[model samples]
Target: MHMISALLFGAPDAHGSRRRADLVQDLLWAHSDPEDAVQHIRVRPHPVGLEAVLLLGGRADGAATAVVALLGRSAAPLSRQGYTALPPGAPVQPPVPSGPGD
Candidate 1:
């Protein structure tokens, strides 16, 4: 499984509560594949903040890639808040590439 996080910006549109709900639904649909089985999807809203955390099992890379695509499509400015693996650790350093002198 993999987890993806994103921060949604901008104010609610007409219809108030319904607008926010529709936006959230659209975001989820945009980020998820109908065929794929999603393990968990969570949406949290604050007075001035909207956060979404998606837990996807199976081939999670697809879901992660979809999120990047959806963020690009969204009219509202969405920023990638942060990300972490299951162990909740920093990234590993790749082996240094050998120069001309080996």
Candidate 2:
């Protein structure tokens, strides 16, 4: 099994963050595969709004796909209610060495 993490922002307050976290948990429970794909979930306050993390169990790609779908499905309504998702940063690549052969 693999683990995937998601972060959500823009909750008005701690209560709002907790509520949104609960909604996310419910959605995952109802929609994810095996009915237990969500292994763990958490929410904490952030300066901009709130932060949430979800640990999912499954193949990495599949888990990512599920999260994408879940976010897509919730984005509109959530945005209308003032919640936003924190986009992930691009993966860093190692620098390649270029030198004359000895």
Candidate 3:
């Protein structure tokens, strides 16, 4: 499913990449406003390590960059149809079943 959010995350150590998503979320929430609920979170990957993509309840225009700065890590944007995030070792699920053709 497509998500509306700012994808800004950093690399993780090879040993614990699977759990990095939760860690990134914690850091974001810790620095973000209490009301800006994180609607979506995807644990993807990076050349260096794992990363996270977050769709907040409110506008996430600058949140990604901010997080990058706050965390002192590099950041990148998630395009509408470009980069994708898939958890390591996760099985590729089949696409959602569509309705019968007319």
Give each model a TM-score.
0.45, 0.56, 0.38
Residue-level lDDT tens digits of model 3 in 1-102: 223333332343577655565555555455444444545655554554445565555455544444344333221222122333333223544224368992
In the range 12-54, model 1's lDDT, one tens digit per residue, is: 3434544454557556666555544556666665333455566
Per-candidate Cα lDDT values, in order, are 0.50, 0.57, 0.44
Q: Which portions of model 3 miss their true places by more than 4 Å? A: 1-12, 35-37, 58-102
Output candidate 2 Cα RMSD.
Answer: 11.1
lDDT of 1: 0.50
How many steric overlaps does candidate 3 have?
0
Backbone clash pairs for candidate 3 read none
By summed lDDT, the worst window of 10 consecutive residues in model 1 runs over 81-90
Rank order (by lDDT, best first):
2, 1, 3
Residue pairs clashing, model 2: none
Give the per-residue lDDT digits (tens) of candidate 2, residues 1-102. 655555555535655666665665565455445444667655555565545566778676666666666666667655665666654332323224368992
| lDDT, model 1, position 16 | 57
lDDT winner: 2
Better of 1 and 2 by TM-score: 2
- Which should have the higher TM-score, number 1 or number 3? 1
